[model samples]
Target: MIWADFSDFVSHSRQHFEEGLIRAGYEEVDGGWSGQVEHIAGRTEIIISLPPRFPFVPPKATPANVADVPWSWHRERNGALCLVADDDHDGLWWREAPAFLEHIAAWFESCHGDWKDDRPDLDLDRYFHAANDDRLYIYGDLEAYRGEFVRFGTAPNNAMVMKGRGTRPAKVSKHLRDQFGYVADLGTVDVPPRNWKDLLAHIDASGYLERKIRERLIGLLVLIYQRGDHEGTTFLKVTPTSNGGIDVRRLRSGADTPAARSARSGKDSVELGTRGIAVIGVGAVGSFVADMLIRAGVGRLTLIDDDVVMPGNLIRHLVGPEAVGRPKAEAVKDQLGRQYRLRDDQVEAMSQNALTSDVVFQVIQNHDLVINATADFAVTAFLHAAAQAAGKHVLSAALQNHGDTIRIDVLPPLAGARPLPASASPENHQEPTYYEAGCGSPISPTPPHTVIETAAVTVRHAIGLLLDEPVHPSGEIRQLKHTRNQ
Candidate 1:
């Protein structure tokens, strides 16, 4: 019996397998490739299995055990068989595969005509071009499909076959072996990943696992278990450990884990906690950046803003009437604490101006990134100079009124080299400036049309910057229309 299966993606593994078989003078007989199937041809039988991911990630494939097969022929003792040219990133297997096969037949003929025992070394140029051509096969490239993958395959006649094993089988084909990138050969039966506990929990709880939906569900579960439990929300600290170990303790939190009650209920302390963000403002724009930095998973946050919330700011500021008269830093801290479920120690609040000699500057030195979200031009200039001299990345967002219209600007770090200090050439430096009022109204009688169009654009601009995606400013904005004026 012969078995063959395609990966869940057009990865390097499938490319390696198909290219290997094709180079061996074997032609796919059927409709491309199939998964987890067996075909019997006389006394010979072969089985195939694919791992969860392919290409950027590899799948696990092992041979089935037979009653009487030579062990040496079945499994190599020394020199492991890794997927085709896994060491080289510029190979066909590393690239997408759908279109790569178009010229593969010609490539196979050219290479095999000379009978080279070893596979030919590929030039980086030819490999990248072939790999890039697979884009024609991808449906669409968008954020919705980030970290997503798909798979398809075919078994050719007189070339390869598919077979199913009853638990264990012997003598796996090199084709399957190379496709999965196995060092030697997968063991008798493909061992379900240890993370299968969460995978099974998902399927059993959900009651249905369509082949299409299973991969996505598993990926989601992995993400939840990774971000929610095992690793805290800090981006830099959220790295996976070696040994494929899952920090189960990190994954299970709150009601999900029974041990939540056993953990300390007081302030949660992080190591080297003194070094963290010190936000100088907590206005609408500033609050949004704080949220972005937090969601970007900054480990620690220290807020310093002296302004007290007023009733008018309730419309735009994240705080409200109940927070009126309260210091902005404390208000933001209290609000974010609710959203992120921050422990007492993860956040600290202070009320003050961010002047040069101010304690806030001392706190700012500890942070990795400083954001100047203040509307005051003087404050912005000081922050720009101070942060630049300290070699820190500064991000700021602002809105300018164009008479019934608002244009949002997101100033990222300067390109190429860091900006020189204002002290170096005081004459050459200009103060940071913007012409927007605290009330967020245009300086003149603005047209309602421009107001409607620009307001929508400003919100979208702000969000795109927060999401760290590219955004075009050609009068683009998020729209808000009245539906019969409720």
Candidate 2:
């Protein structure tokens, strides 16, 4: 009845395997039973290692010889026969020996396919490394074995663990030395990290070399879905550091998840991840900011503006001349879906007159963050008060003067040191604006580059605020000058 007892579960789970292997005259080895299984690909010897606690702990099975299977989850250095890690509900790992043998046999058969064949099924590696941070960078081609984790364990001499990477597991250490012809004596010799190479080159590089590839307590799976799905097996290495800090390096095996794509493409950032953002204007500045936020990976965006696009808007707005009649918000939303590949549901184009809309507060409440670039006095005053009442962070950016200087005001949540502007006119923030006599013309005719460049600066700060990283001078007006031909 003991979970770790292999004999109790043997007859119940794998009677045929035991009987057949015994009849074939298999031998006992490595604290378990061993036998050769013949498949279409070739003959592979299996080693089943049962621990003291059986069913509860599950058994560790490995192949006696090396195998190169295209099972999506590459393989470990010691070649762990990665069945289910803990088979509770028939998850990814080996639950019962008979079923596992059948599945693994299929895996072996899959290896026969050409390397160029594109698999339709999701890769097993996709189920691992859910964090998908580009934390590891290497010059070597570790494409097949990225995101592999190995618990090198604490050195016998007891070097401190670094960022949860170094664990000095004994069996894994010896395996690295025997297989890779490198020194990994954590008890006697200290381990060296990639950065330690410079120091070791001058003194000694053989101290902690090759230990990563031979880890026994291999971190085969960076992720194992608990409430979701199951996937496993990976090829990764872990070495020790002279300063006691461990560096975990993985390959570039990719996935379609946003996290994985961000890591692979080097666009991973706090504010760039999935988020609900509301932009209350899609003019030249708002349009440019919206574009940057989308490209930065803001998950869902709601563009709010009642004004229609004009021919002049084409020069500075995100859209072209053909979109002259469409509302700025709706046009930007369409562009996001059609050109930027964002789903229609991910973007919302609203034509609500923000200056007069009573639901502006409700709209602001629905999003995680609000951004105002309309630069209208009524709209700014309304949003400032409504956002504060709804307990949301809002950023307002506007052209303060004709001399290429723009100002952005950040309202950090719960930091009510200053009140919202009473009026958006020169009387409110004591800022200057240029407006010609009756016709609404630009103060100094802002250029496309100036507007876009200013929007980029505001967006950088807005991103930080969306992540709760309030921009410095939180409620104060921060004016930024554009870099243009003087």
Candidate 3:
């Protein structure tokens, strides 16, 4: 009856699993099965325990004499063998009992060879036991301050590392008050210390800290050490042992620098880091456009809007219900900052209407490009005139045909380039039905997918203009009638 619960066992019968285990020299145990695997390092007794969910989850394997096995990259702190990377989704091994046992054998073989062919994993924090606390330490560049003491500010659940020991920088102190600092030291080894004894031995041998300094410290200690060719961080908590030795435990830590965030994009992000842009409107389409530009590595942004987030906006807006009553521009800015770890100077929010603001021309002149997503004819005309006077490029995008069509217009900052004719407007097509929301003007029905699709096309052109790529002078218009049913 237990086999009936799992479809996999029905196909490869429970009797087959028993026969496979017996042939592999394994015996049924009280919880699961046990077997001994031979490797170059001798024999290891592996115990595989099937989870309650059976075939839905993979069986967990661990050594019977866990303490006797040496630490390696493929071993977890809880003694379970890490058979695959965290992101691996292949289900071949867990589909049946025989394949699962074979995976365990391969893991032991890899351990025997010392994992020399394994790719480098810069995160060394996983090898050791973490402290009980949940506080996370966020740091920036520390290459210049290696071997020197640095200050940090404490918040509710996290702390920020600041450089130097003098008066705390006004920019950081405003958000987080100064709590404590740590000494940034470079380690000699690329791998993490095996255990508390190994860590204490390294500290004594390196002479990075004196007895008085180590004893005076009361909390977490951060080490900015080298890992192969790159850098890595390690957080440790040191306490005195009964034998006069020190016990060290690793803590959670992360890097928050611009270089760390943009490392995924490689060289493509380098040019965009120096570019700035201003967006007029933070509605469904505009919010997504701003978010995409930030993720693409645009260094600076100015968000301008006069509307506030309403409950109805949540269907397509970038923000959540928590930002319902807040200004659209400020909410979008906060959302982008939390997602990208942007500083205050990186994003500026202006809760003023661009059409009515007296300094709208100043904003246009400050950025490399301006994006208009207000979908208002009057606002579009006003922005085009302002961009012309300021000698800047303006990109306008809108959804038409009840969200089935997307229109994008580009006005280059050239002497002879002019705006597209009025025929380009959706108003020239069949009139769209509008739904009333009780108080304000009637709104057209545009689904979330159409808004996202429009934003993608609009941002593609914006990035092309910023990177000086060739673009059509009149811009592009796309029809999505075939995809409307979805």
Candidate 4:
């Protein structure tokens, strides 16, 4: 039988008057809650009544049973839910109405078959008297209705705030505005007006005008405008039980105004870093290529690889022992992330191998320059085919085993160059590959190591190539061939 609290039933009173049933005290039945209803199908009946908190709270219910069952309904044992007594301050009274009706309905059916006189109130016809005695009112017509709540943006005052880089957490709001002499418009949050004249006028012409604060203010204003209205006034109000993200109650759905659009476009472009470069593979040589590009002021560096640093690589890799186990891309990014002059976002890390032409093509298509540092033949072949097809400039480098010599090549679009046959001698190849043999071996862990020393030279050359600067001592290829019969 369902038993809804009196106070709760009235608050949730909907237009429909659904049925309710009282319970049979917390008793364990063989078939569960569903099966208990079958047991009392013939002997018991119920009458649902609405309390003051009608629709918003559970409804009130009383059951009448004749098949000799002595029992009273009780709440479920687990943790208390919305419809349970613990959820209500008035002791299961002012909860919700519909929930009450549901409980009563289940209890009425439970007492029919498991008839026992030892149970309390075995009177099948007397249950309806409780509803009549309390004079519980019936809400809307006994009809069913279903609806749901929809929220836009964040709800209430809940907001997600990201601290700007180098921004200290001191009185952020006041300090930012006071120092920068800018105001964070908490209004509609659309687009901030360009006229900082008013805020500037309000600034104390003395101690408040520091360069650092002024710089932060300008940066913050630009950032806010870039985020546009969505991140503005939208706040979420959520309790622990809420679903999805924070709820947003206020919505601004109108199209962007011309001024807002222009401001947003300008702000957005400046914030997007560089979107036209891909770095495939961040291995030994690849890292050098990326470093050269970054130092030469390349637009951005998008790195891709699926390998992690291992202990054995401590000898030759640019990264140190601290970065031993990190993904190469991430390690590269971590190193670059600390470089204040560099655009951190520009150095992305794709934790996957550049295995196919398609994979190379997808990344190359979006970038103006493709730097293949992976030093893998499969990856190199894919890069050549894809970058050549897409007309993207490709730079690839490799080194012979240990420290024989280094090879760096610039592959522009195929253009008018002679194409080699599917099968051709190494000498007949149009593009030259530097095959350095026994130039120098790396000195073990000491300062005058060959790998450490030569790497510096090769990286400088790469930088010159990227920046179109003059190469020192001419950028000609050198081959260290072995002489026989001396």
TM-score of each: 0.35, 0.43, 0.66, 0.35
- The TM-score that candidate 1 achieves is 0.35
Worst 10-residue lDDT window, candidate 2:
183-192
Q: For model 2, how does the per-residue alpha-carbon lDDT over 218-294 read when each residue is reduced to its tens digit?
A: 33223211111323222223345466643334333223334443443224455455688888888989998888887
Task: Give the Cα error of residue 214 in candidate 3, in Å.
Answer: 7.9
Q: Would you list the C-alpha lDDT of every candidate in the order shown?
A: 0.40, 0.56, 0.73, 0.43
Residues 1-486, candidate 4, lDDT per residue (tens digit)?
A: 245665444433333232222243223233211112223345333333444444455543333222233333231111111133433545553333344445544444443433233223111111111211111111111112111112112222332122112333334654332111122223221112212232233232343422424333222221111122233221111111134221111111222233332343333233223445577777766665566555544557788989998776566666778899899889877776665245566678888878855677778777766666665787777777776688765666555433344455556423444332122123322223343344343332212244444445555554544445525322324333333363
> Please, what are the lDDT tens digits per residue for candidate 3 over residues 337-382?
9988788999999998787746678888788988999888888889
Task: Give me the runs in candidate 2 sitting further than 4 Å from their true place.
Answer: 1-272, 412-414, 418-443, 473-486
Better of 2 and 4 by lDDT: 2
Candidate 1 Cα lDDT to native:
0.40
User: Where is the poorest 10-residue window by lDDT in model 3?
Assistant: 164-173
Clashing pairs in 3: none
Instruction: Look at candidate 3 and tell me the lDDT of residue 90.
Output: 69
